[model samples]
Target: MAPKVLVVLTSQDKFPANGNPTGWYLPEFAHPYEVLKDKTELVIASPNGGEAPLDPGSAKAFENDPISAKFLKENKSLWTNTQKLADILPRVAEFDAIFYVGGHGPMYDLHSDANSLVLIQEFAEAKKPIAAVCHGPTVLIKAKSTSGEPILSGASVTGFSNTEEDQAGLSSVMPFMLEDELTRVTGGRYVKAAQPWGEKVVVSKVAGSGSTLITGQNPASATGVGKEILKALGL
Candidate 1:
């Protein structure tokens, strides 16, 4: 049997207090999806089951990209019937790894959601390779080790930076600044690229666990994040 991966997305469609709409970032999921689909089986899920909104900007900008195009062309059950996080928990052990795709929506939904915490915990306990990019890494905020330490504590990680968030013009609107929260949680290293949108990928093997926890700084690092994750999994 092939390795299986569970991909989680945010259910949030509109920002709080009547802010602009958002969903999963296309490139972040596309690059990783295209990279791993041929080699591993993938299951797409959301905090809430069913349709997942796509970030209009990312969906529009990358509409013509081969991988993104393919995702749209093949609108199968995978696209329409996203399992709820709880529904998949029973079978979480079947997965060899897990992924989280980012968009502004994750800040509102995945960042502090309970279901996400459990899913992250299960994957970590199973010692699977877990990869998240951009704001997707936001979900790691709730993941804790067996000893109840933050999953990102002492682990080299990166996510959408405060500088990049400012570039996106969402510093004031986002619930809490992502990079700032990440840095606080890790209390170790939270590196980012010198340039806001530049690519940066960090892979850390948490001591005593042998599990690979990988993160990408932003959308530009999506493919790099995907590749590093596959490498960590020894593919």
Candidate 2:
């Protein structure tokens, strides 16, 4: 049997402010999917499951980008029939590792989801690799240890930066500043690229748990994040 990895996506489809459409950012899913699918038995799960929405602007790939195009072409059902997080949550230990894809969507759903927080704790306690990108890191803010401590306490990580959020024209629309939350969640270093939209990836360890985290700064950092995950898994 092949190594199995769980990919959790946000089920939220509307932005909080005006109920504008939003979902998992595609390239963030695509690049990582391309990298992991070839090496592991990738399974898709989500908070609500069934047809995770794709951000309109993210549904298409650059004509020259093969990986994104490949994911769109090959993983149609995997995206369309995503299993519910509740289904996967109890079995997180069965996976070699777990990844969360980001978009504005995660901010609304995965951020506070009880199931997601439990899955995060299960993965972290077992010392499995926990990877997330962009706004997906919001889940980290809600996850706590058995001692009721922030899971990210005293660890290095990065996510969609405030600068990048502003650049994307959604600074005022987001619920809370992601960078600020990440910085405060851990009291550890939370640095970003010198400029917005630059590719940045950080591989950090949990303060007490032996688990390692691999986080990417933005969509452009997706592939890099995937590569780091493979390295962490010894693939």
Candidate 3:
């Protein structure tokens, strides 16, 4: 049997004023879900529990793309039965790995969520690979391991860059930019692709730690991020 992987998503359903609702982008979450489900048992969890909204605009390509549509329909159950982040507390330790799916929602919600923070820390403490993409890496801003050290400290990682934020016309909208916060929290150099919306993923092994944290630049990096996670696990 394939290893069991917990895919954690943000449940924030509202967008900031004059902004778009931020949750998991359909392609970013669905593409990885499709690939990972084929080799592992997948479980979905979210911050506020229950349903996660998909950024409608981000679903544009998948709406016209047949393969993405089929994958979406096939995973309807997982989509419908998302476990609340709080509800998954006791069960987090059971997963082989954890993946945080990004959307604008994470920018507003993931940082202050203690349950989400703890779970990420739990995975880090266990030395399991933890993966995130796009805005998903926002969670790492405040995620401290059991030792109280921020997880990304001194670890090279990438996330939805400020350049991408500027390109998306959301530089002033988001509560905080992931690139700036990740760098501030860890004092580590956070890097990104020179261009916005490019596929740039960085996988770094936490200094002297067995766990590998992988992050992708934008929605475009979802599949590459997933592939890196698989490689990290030797799958």
**Which predicted model would earn the best lDDT?**
2
lDDT of 1 by residue, 36-85 (tens): 87888889999898988788888788887887777767754564679998
Q: Give the runs in model 2 whose Cα sits over 4 Å from its true position.
A: 60-64
Clashing pairs in 2: none
Better of 1 and 2 by lDDT: 2
lDDT of model 3, residue 49: 64
Give the lDDT of residue 219 in candidate 3. Answer: 75
The models' CA-based lDDT, in order, is 0.84, 0.86, 0.80
Clashing pairs for model 3 are: 22-105, 49-84
**What shift in Å separates residue 144 of candidate 1 from its native position after superposition?**
1.0
Worst 10 residues of 2 by lDDT: 56-65
Clashing residue pairs for model 1 = none
State the local distance difference test value for candidate 1.
0.84
- 110: Cα error in model 3, Å: 1.7
Report the number of clashing residue pairs per model.
0, 0, 2
